[model samples]
Target: MTSGVIRRVLLSVGVIGTGQWLLSDVVHVPGGGLGVAAVAGLWWLSRSPKQPRFREPASLKGWIERCELVLNQFEELEVVLELQGLRSPREKELRRIEGFDVPLSVGVVATEGSGVPATVQLQQALAGAASLDLCLANPLPVTSTSWSWPDDLQELDVLLHVLPLPLRAADLLWLDQLPADRPVWLLLRSSVDRSAEDHLEALRCQLPERWHQCLLPWSGEAIELRGVLQPVRQQLMRAERVREGTRQRLLNNLHRRWQADLETLRRERFRLLLQRSQWIVAGVVIASPVPSVDLLAVAVGNGLMVKEMATIWSCPWSSEVLQVVARQLGSAALAQGVVELSGQALLGLAKLDGASWIAAGAMQGLSAAYLTRVVGVSMADWMALNAGVAEPDLEELKRQAPLLVARAAEQERLNLAGFAQQAHEWIQERNSCTPA
Candidate 1:
């Protein structure tokens, strides 16, 4: 008990130290003067919290159904982009999993020499499967080796290559074409008990080392056939798991591609929506003298933008959720002094003096717009991370504020010139619309 306790304590310490190093030193992504706590929080939030499985998994049909629904959502997102003269054909990739099979079948291929004798050996071998651990149906056909079969040869789960003594050149050519992903067992047979293994091992260097284990010596008798077929049975038993894993992988890959494409289109829509929301907030700032209701107006405008963003992601949202994201980003932006930095940036762009009121409205408009962009971008990232998860905890947004705000700031800084031009035009248009 004492040794086990000490070992566990040491393991816990090592794990903590490794996680600390990974957060503090390995991942420097949030490094634009952001605090170490922010980086640590970001790394923590990014990991999936599911425990590892040690046993065989149940059927994944339910998960596959959810993916199908997501594919339908992808089609809807595609229609949104198509309205603006852009076409995305990737949603159609979901057709790959339409008729996927969950079970695997087996096939056999035999060499030229000892044709009838090889058939007898294989027949007895498959007959012995009754005593094996796995229940396998023996599709017994004493088939001759061929390069390819007429019917769907891919249906075969395990291909057993039967070898008779005295290796032939044609046998090597036949072995070369067998599928690499599927296992091919080399069933070795001898007519007499005095036969040597060297004659059968002529192609040893050319074959994989793992295939060498499948070499079994038999004079083709019924009693010993069961053990010969055990290894082949084991490989076939894993076919269902392999097929399930493959289907899931195909669906997941398509989902990722759809996500990337969808995010690209949604980013453009986010900027457009932020432009409209910030202009409304700017008008509110100018309309109110005392500024008590200005915050409410900004909140309302941002709430609508969040709702629209949720619609874009095919998710539902609430006002409370909106407040959580907006409040966190607003405070972090101010804490990082990005609001002042943005104001100073516009003052330099307009080439106006600090005391000049000429660009004040434009500055106000752009500042509000900048914060909205950061919040919208941050919300998009959070939604993407929490998609398909029902009722994700809102507190994660609170904990993830600094990293989300910093990352969005970095992203928005890339197109500052274009945004400045849009902000200037927005202010001028609003000024013209006002009564003289």
Candidate 2:
């Protein structure tokens, strides 16, 4: 924290804390200075988004640095998966490429009949587009064999799908499936439609959300379409000036794919960890003699799960640091009666009530396990966000706790059916093995 930011934060906290102390009804929690400071700091952080950026850089060099950070995040994800004896898709090193060249490559796909002639007119209109090698939507005479988009122009920076209305279902599906990496313009050649603006209102209902603005209405000669493209040309020109423009766009495409792959792998590995951890906690609870012992046993086991989760994110948060997060989330859950609610809702959630559930201390054990998962997963999110930044102290964790816990609870509620089945099976197995 900078001296100025720290001074301002302290001043605000001091005013709030003094008011809180003077008011008898307010909470006076011991060792809650961190949570108190968290409230002010979070508000301050929200107001100022230009917080000390670490990986964010200027020009092409900045892009390269962000790419490195993404690579490292994936590398950690791979390690986490590997520890579980599960192999993840290898994340190859993203290195700097010298003298990189980028082109505003555009692809055009047109409907048959009059659409083919309209595309040729478009080619003539854009004859001076020197930077881009625009795809000829229909280079050869119209035939069933040439209906497909050109295979050679697979890597496109922009696309123009010329359609003679009424629009076809196949065309709408194609546009929907197309990735949002580049701009796509739907060149409509409808005889009945007056202007492209007329089709814009209609196309909004059928087209994907992203392509709503990229619609171009063509009524007169294809050469007149150039006027419609002025805005598109300006957008492209602006992109060209940004971080060597074309090169940055291509890099971003690759980076987005890498991050997406990492996310899939991370979720798979995290699921496996949660499954193992939750089952173990359930076993501990079932084996314990009483409700008091069950809580203690569940806590001890849950702490280990939290530790493993932190290790996966490569977080430097100590056990004490983790406990602070757990404490905040747990208090929020308890205050909202989430603990009691989850237990009571378990059978209702899964719609399962059986002899297995009626077994000795079954409700206590199952609820303990369920609550462990809610708290553990919530901690994982906190760790993941802060792991990239500086290690957040108690204040930051407490500041984020209520929101994160509430979100996690809502998400878990949606998946209660699957969890209920798992709990039912676990209890059945336990009952079968234990002496009656």
Candidate 3:
């Protein structure tokens, strides 16, 4: 109910009650009706329904789709396939070429001079491939032979045939001289009566950048193919390297920016959450398990991150050489100060003392996650505090030392069992500490 309506109702009840009360109490007229009416009015005012307001939730699906679409626009995989004469062998070749695994549009341009045999094959091969405008340049006019092409592929043409004749051998000198609208791959007799290198060089000199050469023998055999696509391959390699470097650089930059932005957002989220939550201790069951410093920062920045804690704790250290190390950690050697036990001692400490110290610290809340702001912790302090652990020498355990073997075997079993038991105890302990 609105405050306005409530106020008016309360006012009416007050006036009516006052008039009645005046007649009864002041004028001595009897009846307890005025008080009852006032109570009823107030109750009615309190029982009205409130209007609801609605809001839309924040969703990023639309934005994500738009971003993906934009990224896909940069994909470059277009390649054009060029076929000159589609004959018997050419038909088979065309089928194979079209069948090749390439996600590109193939544009075939047949010469008008190609015999009817080649022309029929070309038309058939064009059945399932992309057909750019076809140009025919024959001496005599032919019947309407191109009528049966698919509607989408009926764009045929009649152009001058400027090769293999009056267009002298030297006339074909410039492959670059071809029209820019076309992507060319000359299908010539592999073993021409003349030199292959000279022929290729002549065509290479004349063709425009649009021309890409692929030599095929008259027999259409794959084994006999020449021109290993070397030039095109080289160009593609250079372009690929340049593109890869650019893409890698862009990815790195984007990742770095994302990390920076996320870090700031996380900090904000943490602050907001803290304001809305309470952190009461269930007594000092364990001194603020939260360390006064961040463990990850200390480990990484100080170069003391645990390297072999899992192995020493979980795997046998005797036949494993690591069990012996676990024994040394809680042993007198650890208490005697920085006692450096090269083999067994190091391994034992890594498993037992190192794990216990770190685990105890973690449970106490002396973890990196809580101490993100502390910057004074150093590598030495981290190592001294058991934040750093080393690998166990499995190979050495199998060596000729009897004392090592005996101790390793005992330590290995204890380390594994201790690790499991400790894990369970920590969980129970932490749960008990959290306030209900």
Candidate 4:
């Protein structure tokens, strides 16, 4: 509250107390004091800050219902799963065709003598996973488990896990094609006659290098192996590009959808800031010419500030525009016969006066025609006279430094005569206002 209001409140309280004492017969000093204390205590209590209360999370049923609703919107999806287990060489080969059959479905079953049952453990461990995969756990006390096609469990892809058997023989007998691409990982039990090293060495000589095979130890319930599906770098690059495109599209859609909603616009703006502020502005600051100039100044300042934040030493700006300006400075230094000074030094010199190097650089890169369209001048008149050029037309190069640079480059190339005319007009206008 304002001090005036506080003073008025105090004065009002005093007036009321005095009025009660003078006009009322029952007004006692102790009662009046007690009343005033009570009022003060109430006011203090009312002015205390309040804490916000949190609401409980939505129910599981509600979440599930929402997920179901979303899923209903989609018409098609594909789900695939692969399982690996420990078994005999012959058994593995026999089941290989079945495991690698059409649509590539497999549920690997571990043999009892294969120890620990790696496949079963993996199934039990990942039971609560949010995936479409369903692992059928095979327990110990080995018995011949046949692949059954049950009507109720038609979706389940079954495989009797075993070791290496002849691929041609298995294919001939099963009359099925194997998934040549996917790999089969082996779980080595301690009970095996040969060490895993021996098996791997023998297999390495027979199999192609492209076929990925890893040996994992079966220790009780755990089957451990370190492996990776070799990454496709080209595919990853494409995927990143796709992801960036998707992010941009999503942002564009959201901005369009909520441009008028204040809360949404605020959130979008904040998100854009987080994303390096490359969002498309709906002409928020540049509605008027004066404000447009001011907005440009602020943008330039922010760019410089961002550059300053990146450098260890105090430098003016490191943005692309400033680098252009730095190049110009270097060129100017070179023209002045100071060839010993580096480009970096020239850039530093430009920044020393608190002038925006980026803006200067922007000026450097512009062509005469573009400068005419934007700032109406060339930089040829601003720079020292060039050899074999007509006294550097001062009338045609009357714009600001950056614009002059652009126009000068354009004039050198002679891209547009109309722009030269416009520059002449601007120069004449300036000359007309000058004192004799």
Candidate 5:
């Protein structure tokens, strides 16, 4: 237990020390006194001999009950089977009453002059699969442009293109003309001497970026083909469930709730990391001697924090969007005089007698740090409310910004004091090390 505490302390000190070095040396922050001081204080606290409290584990009965509850909620949806070849006339009669819900109609297009025996074997294997409704289109000659699909082909949910090992130019052109909206799967015949790498490279060079994702190599074996087609089968099953009127609405609600729960868990886990990052940024900002550039530093640091929070919430906003949000939040803080109030509070807490410029710098740094924390918290709340649903309302966020800033100021006051103590300790350590 003693060794574990020592190890953790050492790790913490190392990380903070490295960050300090990077800020001073790489970023070339003028004076770097505040950052160095912050690092030293953090190091001393980390080295302290206090034993951390251990969290208690949940009871076994409670765990078992939770598991049972989850199991009860699990509903098994219908599975769609992938049938390969042409449906036999007799099976067509049986399919009408099989009670399988809207099985995806799959059309297999085998290019002419390709491996006929291998294609035939693949088709046969697919037809034999339990629940799939497969339609094997008539083989088209390499140059034929007038070939028409079967009248029933319009109902196909997916198209599987089976091509020879090295795709011909004509084959590529034909593939380009296929409907873009529907899912398409490309299967290439396996070569005896050539590796999968060679086959992938050949396709990558000729195919568009969109088509690259759909390419798969086929060895003409039933078991292998079944494994490769699993994703397509899953998609078909999902589509069938969506088409079922009442069940579709229930499924959609359940899916949304499940996603929301996942997002909540992720946000909880990331909140700790985000708080730690904000503390570090606060310390760094407080150390900056230049008042003019302090806000810029704060914006950059908080912009990164917003980006990370967006990723945690699975929000698809771009980096530019996040940066804009951070900037707007910062501007709001400035306009509302939140920064000035925070600076005044920090100055009162520090009670440091120094050059007017040094005091001014300290105030600016503390204010920037305070505003950054407020922005981070407000953005996180906004993202949580809109996760996987809709765009965040900037006006709503702006309206709530002042209240968030006030709350953050109260919370950050305690945090800033703790940070100042650490920074003071770091400064003392540096003084002792200096040759007197």
Candidate 6:
């Protein structure tokens, strides 16, 4: 009992210390340490003096209904029907040979004795989401090496590992043997002594960071199943979406016209990532003391952005390919005098005194960053136009680069001041960490 109290105190101290550090060191908030200390004190004061009371668990039917509603929220029924061509008579007849088998096959493995009953309960609860085939597996011992599946089980889409409450590090080793191709979901069942939340935290500590999203806590009671089924339903829906997307990609590959919609979706999805990369690259460039290395840094940053953009667009990614693209784009920008114009615009904004080398470097960095954004945007457009084609036309890209840079400059003019301020703070923080 004394040790528990001591541990709690130590944990509280650690949390408070970490909070203070983030507020003061990372965020640079004024008087952040004292503010965090006060907040911690208030939290400590707010702790309930009375002990928690136990209540009767809800009925199984109530839990089942709640889980059903949660699953309904995912709209799996509508999606499954559409994906399997079951919506209309014509489509249904066409898909008759395919049948209405669940697109995803989920395998449920119970780690402990209690886990077996919990798995059965979960399977019963999920019966309403008829789009998924939930097969409950034999309770596998933690040490078991040769695991067998049901003869009817052809392929497992997702693995649902059911664990008893108060999970240990040893039990998580079972995850190592599971198929890596499929996603793994951990259904944590609470024991009589421990609550579901307690089990969840224990399991979370034992599980790898990647599996954290897959963890779901459930008490044996039906009422708790609603919460547990939410993540499970989401996982199943996500898997279905992935399958549908793959089918779409294959169809697009067969037909050229279908590629337009896929390309547009890819652009929309990766636009924010590209924008963020531009800002990060710009900040890093501005922080560097030397102006001569700006071109090299911008080239490297643009190359990395191209690689990410390629992955998002489902295009082949190679460092060599990015290097060739970057060189062509950089040469065009320089020849068209876009780089020099951007530098002048940034210099005008900074309006720094001649003595300030720091301000001068910042101006160069900001210009390089703006030019990088232009290059990235132009590359995305070129990729979209030449989707599934080999090489980009250097002449056409060169013609478009200046126009794109001018348009980007106009669109981003208002945000530049705010962005520069943020970049300055970032540079300050970065420089403080550098060793002398």
Best by lDDT: 2
Q: lDDT values of the candidates?
A: 0.54, 0.58, 0.30, 0.30, 0.54, 0.53
Among all candidates shown, the one with the greatest TM-score: 1
Q: Candidate 5, which segments miss by more than 4 Å at Cα?
A: 1-248, 259-264, 279-289, 351-364, 395-400, 403-436
- Winner on TM-score between 1 and 4 is 1
**Candidate 6 lDDT score at position 166:** 71
- Tens-digit per-residue lDDT, 165-192, candidate 1: 6555666556556544455577666657
In candidate 5, what are the lDDT values of residues 1-436, reduced to their tens digit? 4764465345434434545653565344555443444443333323433222222113333323332332222211011123232124323322332233565567787777775334455555455434566767766566756544444544455777788877786687677766454468887777778987798897898888888888878775666876666655655566554223223222323334544554545556566655555544544554443334235434434534666777666666655455555555666666667666666766676654333224324445445556666666656666666655445555666676666555655565667776455434433443354356
- TM-scores for every predicted model: 0.52, 0.50, 0.18, 0.20, 0.38, 0.36
- Cα lDDT tens digits, model 3, 107-216, are 33333343222444434433332322233323322224332222221111211222332223333433323433222344443334656555656555655434433432
How do the residues 1-436 of candidate 2 rate in per-residue lDDT, one tens digit apiece? 6775564455444434433332222222344343343343334332432222233233566656656666666656557556532222322333433245465666776544545434466566555655766666554234343244454544565666777666765566555555564466777776663555666677788766787677777775655778766655665565455326444555555555555555566557777788766765565445444344223322433444666776665555555555556666766666666658787787565446666677776777677777777777787777656654444656666677888888888888789888888888776765565555
lDDT of 6 by residue, 255-313 (tens): 23323534555656566766566555554444433354335334445534777777655
Query: Model 4, poorest ten-residue lDDT window?
Result: 279-288
Please count the clashing residue pairs in each candidate, in the order shown.
0, 1, 32, 12, 7, 0
TM-score: model 4 vs. ground truth: 0.20
Q: Which stretches of candidate 4 lie over 4 Å from their true place?
A: 1-106, 110-120, 124-129, 137-177, 181-184, 190-193, 208-210, 214-436
Model 3: runs farther than 4 Å from truth?
Answer: 1-117, 123-178, 190-198, 213-436
257, model 1: CA deviation in Å? 2.7
Model 4 has an lDDT value of: 0.30
TM-score for model 1?
A: 0.52
Q: Write down the lDDT that model 1 would get.
A: 0.54
Any idea what lDDT model 5 has? 0.54
Q: Which model is ahead, 3 or 5, in terms of TM-score? A: 5
Give the range where candidate 3 is weakest over 10 consecutive residues by summed lDDT: 276-285
